[model samples]
Target: MDKNAPKIAIVGAGVVGLTVADILQKDLNKANITVIADKFKEDTTSSVAAGIFCPGSSFRGATLEIAHRWIEDSWYYWQDILKTPEASTAGIMELSSYVFSKEDYGVTRNSFIENLVPIYRSVQGEELKICGPDWKYGSYFTTVKIGCDRYLPWVEKRFIAKGGKIVNGKIDSFTDTSLRQYDLVFNCTGLGAKYLCNDSNIFPMRGQVIRVKAPWLKTAFFGDYDTYIIPGLDGVATLGGVRQYDTYNLKVCKHDAAAILDQCSQMLPDLKKVEIVAHKVGLRPHRVPVRVEPELIGGLKVVHCYGHGGNGVMSAPGTALNAVKIGYDFLKTNVKNKI
Candidate 1:
């Protein structure tokens, strides 16, 4: 390690934090980086997600342009990964998905990626019947899914190989003395930001999903009530789910499981015969506008990049890419001020 390398600290180990570390390791070769978090790998909420590329209509940054860029940049980022041999090893895969809603045609349409993805169009009347005879409104799109169960470990391997350090500890405050020596910090704490930043605007949007062994399921299917069935690696299909706003309970609710199974089975009758793999729950850190900005915290330079809610896996790369650029600029300014 260079004796004078910039000492950088990232205070979360989830997808957002690790992606920041991954980008920093590549962007700033001489930086000594450390990832500090209470949780790691599969223990994180990121693991609970089926990790599809679809973003909620409400997902946004400080501005519409920035929000669109995050999704656009992320799509291309995954596209690059999808072309490489590491795609499978990294748990990234392509998916052809259908989103349908009996009550609203708007639910089937996504303005964000209509022009970006390979396909995004209204589904045919025959296609609506693909899920069930009662389905009315639908749209078909080609997308991507990232399995954090494999992705988190894969990225960690790459990060550690590049000389980055990982530490397991909970951070309750940005003013922690241990962070004094670091030249800058990146707050990718996700839901923890609600407490660390003491920002009431950040709230949890709880989600629950089920994993089933259905080798026959190749494409993904989505319905109203946030119900979705996304296919992943290893013949595992993620069936979900409910979005309970302001709820923090993480335990698997039996009621949720029964409802999810019923909804998913209705979409694909064959799923009723699939073996149950697991049930997972996560609290998405939701905010009106996703926070990704610079802050002066206790005389330390920090870049805040959390509150992605349900879209963390889909948008991590894009926002992390932006965070690195902003952090690099912060480092340059810090150097100039010291000199």
Candidate 2:
């Protein structure tokens, strides 16, 4: 390791921060990189996520073009991993999903992935009946799911083996004394940015999900009202959820669990019989046009990369790549004006 290389600090150990760390280490072979976070693996919100690649139509970046690029780049990044022998250990796998809506046809259509996925098309005649006769609209598409349960540790091990440092600590502010030694910082703190950056736009969009033993379920399912069924590694499948905007409650609500179980069971009755493995809650860092710009804070060069909401798992790589590009450009100049 070069003792004088530019020091880079990455905050947050969730999917976003770790993804940025992984890519940064790969892109800058000898750059001193450290990942600082208070939580890891199962303790982080990313662990509770369904990890499906399908983004809600509302997922956005600064603009439609930027958003499209993020989705496209992310799809190819995961695709590359899926083709490798280490895919299973990395917790990435190809999954075919069926999104159904009984009310709005628009819900079944995803503009972000329609042209990107190999098999994204409308469901024909009896295809809708597979879930139930009442289903009026549906679309089948191929995508990937990243199981952070396995992915976080998998990436962390590779990162450490590559000489990347991991620090288990909390960063209360960008100017925290602990960060003074670093030349640059990448802020991927997710919802924690709400307080750290004084960012009012980012808030907790609480989501609750239940993991169940359903080895028989191979395909993902989505119904109206934010309900979804996503298969994961092993025999565990995730059934969820409710999107309560501006809600900060992280404790699992039995009522919400009951509703989720009822809704999911209605779509696929077999779910009612599956053994419940765990109930999880995640407070998504909901923000429109996800923050991905550079700023000089207290004479420190910083690049912000949080606010991915529920799409962080699938979109992390692309946005992280973009953040790295901006950070490199920012590093080229010595200007320190706060922006």
Candidate 3:
């Protein structure tokens, strides 16, 4: 640690937390950094995400411009990383995906990433036959997927190598620690923030998925009704899911499992025969718009960066970069300057 550097702590171990740590390390080279979290790796909601780069139109920031900036910044951040040798090990990969919908044409369109990604265009008539018949609306686009299973560990290792520290314990409250000890703290604790800040706006959007061996499946597919088959780095592909609103149930529902299999098999009948690897459930920390701002609580400076919903993995870096800028501004605060 640099003796003159400011001491900083980041709370949370998910993609958002790790991304904040990564950016902070780069931006504040001399700062002493430590990541405090009760959960890590597979324990995080990030791992459960299919990690497609498509952000819903509903995903927002404090303002529309801010939202678009976050999305654009995040895309380039991953694109830069994808060009490196560590891309695969970091679980970053270029992916081609097909979005199909029979009811709503808008469901097959994405304004967020349509013009941003490398490729975005209407699917050709023959391309519609790639999945199955009767698909009225369809679009094909090239994007990226970050497998948190690999990304979390990869980032954590890099963080530590760069002189960052990790403390594995749940932070009950920001007031639990001395405010003066660290210059600032970043709150990236996902659903944990609901309790930490008593935020009612944040709720859980429950999701369930099945991981199965399907290396032959190279492209990603999203059918109607939250049904998706996303291929991962390994031969395993994720079949999902159910977005039960305001539901915190982490236990996999048998009914959801059956329904997922039914829907996925309908898209590709061969899925019915794929060996089941595992069934998992996670509660996405959902809010109207993702929270990314600085707050002063009980004399401690903290930046809030949670409520990413299902798009956490895809958007974490962009939001984290913004959060780090806020944290830095708070640390350099003049007594009369207001945040």
- The TM-score that candidate 1 achieves is 0.97
Worst 10 residues of 1 by lDDT: 330-339
- Tell me how far the alpha carbon of residue 151 in candidate 1 is from the true structure, in angstroms, after superposition: 0.6
Report the CA-based lDDT of candidate 3 relative to the real structure.
0.90
Q: Pick the candidate with the highest lDDT.
A: 2
The weakest ten consecutive residues by lDDT in model 2 span 330-339
TM per prediction: 0.97, 0.98, 0.97
What residue runs in model 3 are displaced by over 4 Å at the alpha carbon? 178-180, 336-339
**Weakest 10 consecutive residues, lDDT, candidate 3?**
330-339
On residues 1-339, what C-alpha lDDT tens digit does candidate 3 reach at each position? 789898888999999999999999988787799999999999888888889898977898988788888999999999989999999999999999999997889999998888798889997687888778888899999999999999999999999999999999977777784335776889999999999999999999999999999999999999999999999888999999999999988888999999999999999999999999999999999986889998887778889999998888988988998998888788888542222
> lDDT scores for all predictions?
0.90, 0.93, 0.90
Q: After TM-score superposition, what is the CA distance of residue 74 in candidate 3 from its true location, in Å?
A: 0.6
177-251 per-residue lDDT for model 1 (tens digits) = 888878889999999999999989999999999999988889999998989999999999999999999998989
